[model samples]
Target: MRPPAQNPPTPQTPDPATAAGAPEPRTSPDTPDAHEPPDGEEAQVIVVGAGPAGASTAVHLARAGVDVLLLEKSRFPRDKVCGDGLTPRGVHQLLRMGVDIDGPGWMRSRGMRWVCAGRQVTIDWPDLGRYPDFGLTRSRHDFDDILARHAEASGARLRLGVKATGPVTDRAGRITGVTATGPDGRPVTYRAPLVVAAEGASARTAIAMGLERDPRRALATAARRYYRSPELSKDEYLELWADLRCARTGRDLPGYGWIFPLGDGRVNVGLGALPHRDHGTIDLRATLDQWLARLPRHWGLNEQNADSPLRSAALPMGFNRHPQYSRGLLLVGDSAGMISPWSGEGIAQAMEAAEVAAEAVVLALTRPDGPRRDQALQRYPAEIRRRWGRYYRLGNTAGDLVFSRFGYRPILNGQVMSRPGLLASLARLLTHLMEDPPRDTADHVLNTLVKAVPLRGR
Candidate 1:
């Protein structure tokens, strides 16, 4: 079956109804393939998807004077199911992209509040000297649309309502561009020197390029819904619950629950679960129904208060895909399975990968086509693996133990969470927010554990 497009490897259409002053859908019933790839202008790189990762890549590349084109099947102000919480790492990426976070509709978070085993402790985000001291939260419907405009403002050409069907390749099998349909449903082929698949969880053209998800890696699922919560909507702390037990087995499922306040009279509430051998896949929607009933009545979150229906999506965790860069095509975000097995965080990693890929693309564009360019392209995956391989490998194993029904353990039990001092250190460790060179014992200990796991990819 074909995968759905988060943003097709083309531009997302601007809804005249939704996006004020937005351009009309670049289509002509009289014209074939709408305008064709590149339409009227030429492009050096073509990006699939207008999500965080893809849009970020375009922003960076456009700033470097590279001609980048974004293809998306949907229109602006589209809704994407997400936790809508940004960690310090994600905040850093947004700042790097020059997003105006001080504006309205943005909520600042001081820290994460962990509720486990009837004990709750708030752990402030670490000042690791690499990321910001605070994080921000905005719904993806606004967030994605904002980022798409940011990319366009950076000089990237966007073609709206175009769905990238597959990769266009050379005889030797390197992707040169993408095959897509216009808003009017006519097929068009876009050609460029390099291609990027930032199409969220669905691999899309990357799959056409011979990349398959690695079954050995951890794959997770998440269900989330928005709720109108007058009391907790403005909360500064993102709340998490770790004491969730399965309704059927009463066993600790290997996943955590989250309540991320959006500060707009609503909060994004959800739970994510890892598969277990004994129970296999758990029913997340049903689990969510059970979970909502358990929330404090003071928070004002319940079925009647739900702002949106419960929606579930897959989280391809732990670098589940191989050769993130290959044969002139690069994968970013969910397409590359950049979600952390440790925290189920993907946006920060995806934006970081977009930056890394942009840097590599800029350098490769400096060289003419052929082996030299391909060599530069190789750095994309290599550097990605270098940065994340060890952490993911370790997290994958840890996740297995945490979620496995036979060996399920509450890593954040009362014993560990009750002690604020210890939980503070553990929080830093779990979030991987430590400076290199071993700033302290916590960093050293955490680094040692991460390094002990043999990395999977080269």
Candidate 2:
């Protein structure tokens, strides 16, 4: 689906009477096709999905003077179900991309306000040499469009209203490109020397290449809706509530809830939970309804104030996929299951991985089709593991062991919440904000601690 226009109408408080209805369908005006593939139909690289990961990869490659083709099923400014919250880590990626954060529609935030068992604590983002000490919240409708446009401006040929069906392989079974359906609903083939799959959780391209999610990893589901709440609209901190309890047992669930202000007379309300193998089944929609019903009446979380229909999506976390690079395909973002198991944040990790992937692809393209190219391509996974392998290993273990037992309450109720220094350290760890080369005490300790742990093995 396409969005209303290039200039998105800012998300505003919805009228209570009209709030519960379905959203209007928006279509792309330029549906004929923006850029048609050449007679050869070959590019230096092909990136699937126009989300943060793919767009970022295309942007980096295009800026480096590579002929990149970016394909997206949906058009620009389309709706994407998300919390719309950005941490300092994500903010760093935006800045690195040279996005104009100083412009309008940017909802600046100070930090995170966590609530558990009626006790509340607000932790400001730490001031570090590597990252900014602030965060922001923006609707995904406009966020992804901005990134895609940024990539297009950098010289990536973006094909909208196109869906890639499967891989195009040669005799040896190495991916040469992808077979897709064009906007006219006709078959189209686009060739490339290499393919980058950033196709979110489904990982269709990667799956067609014989890659699948590891069954042992933890998965989370989150449901979110918007509400008109003037009081919370301009709150400087992203609010998180960790006290959601199951309906029957009244026991705390193994997840967290959030209330992110949109700064436009509306707020995003949602809850995310990790499913336990032994827990059988959890109805995410029911759970989200139960938790929102418990919110303070003045906050206006009821159906009367609902600005959008409730939406939910699965979260693949803690590197749920293996062998990030196989054959001639490179996996980035949700396709590789790079979402953090700790904070449930994926944008930052996706963009970061895109940078690494772009660098690897650039190096590989410089070399001929030989051992040198393969070595360069192999460095992508190694650098990723060096950066996040150990940390995600610890997080996955915690999800399987700690969160299942007491949720996040034990840590929230402990002295760590009372101690600002420890809380800051925990925040940094959860968001993966620790800098390399040891910038400060927290970074030094966190880096050393992560390195001290053994990397997870296949």
* Best candidate (score: lDDT): 2
Tens digits of lDDT, candidate 2, 356-384: 99999999888765557767988899999
lDDT of each: 0.79, 0.81
lDDT of 1 by residue, 374-412 (tens): 778878888988887788777777877665442223677
Error of 1 at 167 (Å): 0.9
Backbone clash count for every predicted candidate, in the order shown: 15, 0
List all candidate RMSDs to the true structure: 9.0, 11.3
- TM-score for each candidate, following the candidate numbering: 0.89, 0.89
Q: Whole-model lDDT for model 2 versus the true structure? A: 0.81
**What are the runs in model 2 whose C-alpha is more than 4 Å off?**
1-40, 456-458
